[model samples]
Target: MIDAHIHLDQYDQTGIKEMINKWSENGIAGVVAVSTNLKSSYDILKLKQEYPNFIRAAIGHHPEEPPPNTRDLYELIDLVHQERKQLAGIGEIGLPTYKKEELYTKYSEEQFIDVLETFLRVAKKENLPVSLHAVHEEAKKALISLKKLKVELAHFHWLKASASTVNEIVSSGYFVSVTPEVCYRERDQLLVKQIPLEQLLIETDGPWQHGGPFSERQTTPLLLKEITTCLANILHIRYNELLEIICHNTKQLW
Candidate 1:
């Protein structure tokens, strides 16, 4: 019951202990806590120190925003080297999809590609899995770089790609995750059907909102139960069966 991807640092700081306790009580084991920027990377790493068993940190610049400055990017790489043991992966990195046009106003698409390449190399150097944010056409673009760099362990978190692209990703032996959106979103359900049992992971991407059944609810790892139930139904398996398989899939990647 690990949440394969989440912006944990984005959650509220107050009463964090109570929140973790509740999640633990409900069978939520831990999370792959991803970073969105240099500061966020540090925050997640620090949180890992406090809750070593619960937080598997993945630090990197998120792609939908402007690229990191040279000094910050170098520092991030350095931080990764220093804390490689604590990291679950290099993550939340990819080319922008929703923000592509807006980001292009500030920096060229090539700049974003270059940044993603650098982070990919970092992940490769550390021999760590990556949690990617690339979706739509950008997912394919990220896949090209991963293949070029020969990164073997990757999780396309909350992936939104065509059927053909998903097949290619699955064939590459990388993992893909579904968020709680799978409970109500047909698109996510269809995405799950394309993924094999061994490569399927579940996440909440907590602190981010969802519509339908999850509307107005605070996103958290506990939502994994609902996601697991939905996944079980979609995959036509029993609840515990899907749980064990997903847990195994998560470990296989992270």
Candidate 2:
């Protein structure tokens, strides 16, 4: 199975080789490693080169952090153009939620929106799918921008939005991902119910610690086994069948 979204670059290099080998032996097919910044993007691209068949790369500025400087933004755009053939998608981009209050101390919401829209335009022009972080109330704004720009493929990773918004996303044919939390979090379980199986993707969002059973565990694609198991039960499909469908869903996007 594919890990639909993860920050592979954030992992310590000490034993990632062994980690990947282990995950592969356990049945992991590939991962869509997403980037948080320009440097992260370059790192993911390099990883893609090393594991061409095992890593699908997506790159963009994550919205919860400080925006990239103008020069870096332009350079990132240029890099996308130069390496378009190598990228799987544009991602980790969307409106901020967890850091919006702190970010507003220096950057206005409008500024963030502009930067996000700029990247959205780039994604549309590049004709690549998008991996987004938009959640809660801000998800609506991000959806508006995506529709306005006519981006055809997008995955709303770890989405948290109103029932109406979630339905709208499904109706719009956008994909939504659930993390390992679905095993213990009611919110995520309910979310899985809201999205059609065809639009559902599973991710670990690794290196971002989770609570409950995942507490203190170093997140990795290996956790996808538990996530897939939980989802199969929730969706009431056979384990192998659900795995096949979700794998197809991930492939249908990136």
Candidate 3:
């Protein structure tokens, strides 16, 4: 099994290391540690070096941050080109749901779109896959743009989009990751129903959005099997079959 996406830098280093070691012990192959900023992207690179076979890195500026400068985007592109084989994709990048007034207080929507466009261009140039964070209308727009790019794979996590948009995503062959939150949240379950099993992948999105019957604490990749179980129940498929599909998707992207 593979944890398609996670934030290794967000967890306690020692705990994360131990947890990953345990995952290896449990027969998990590898994980893609994504970046939400420049520093974290570099950190992901270092992690890839440390765990060459077990960790893959994806570099991009997340929507939560102010849009990056052109120089920075160029540097990121250069890094991806130089380290193409080591990277899973360009990710954790897209538009936010904040209104224009709120967005301008930190960064303009135009700037966010610009950064997204830049990242899309880089992803196309590198012929790399991408993971997105946009929801609803924004997600729709991102999907339209991605279809025009050279993306090989696309994973949309924790989606909160309209049914039409979700349908479009599924039809377009993009994958959607269901987190453990599905076990406890009706909204996530609704999302699970909307996505087909072939396009569905399970994720932890660990250290954030943690829920379920387990400990009410931070999430980790170890809990991915729980998500798979929830998905299997919802999709009415065997657990192993669902696991195989997710593992295949992870390999296709990373």
Better candidate number, 1 or 2, judged by lDDT: 2
Clashing pairs in 1: none
| lDDT per residue as tens, model 1, 51-108 | 9998888999999989999999999999999999999899889989888888999899
Question: Whole-model lDDT for model 3 versus the true structure?
Answer: 0.80
RMSD per candidate (Å) reads 0.8, 0.9, 1.9
Please write out the lDDT profile of model 2 over residues 28-134, one tens digit for every residue.
99999999998998999998998898999998999988999999899889988999999999988998899988999999999888988999899999888999999
TM values, all candidates: 0.98, 0.98, 0.92
lDDT values of the candidates? 0.91, 0.92, 0.80
Question: Least lDDT summed over 10 consecutive residues: which range in candidate 2?
Answer: 11-20
Ranking of models by lDDT: 2, 1, 3
Cα error, residue 45 of model 2, in Å, equals 1.2
**After superposition, candidate 2 runs with Cα above 4 Å error:** none
Score candidate 1 by lDDT: 0.91
Count clashes in each candidate, considering only residues at least 3 apart in sequence or on different chains.
Answer: 0, 0, 0
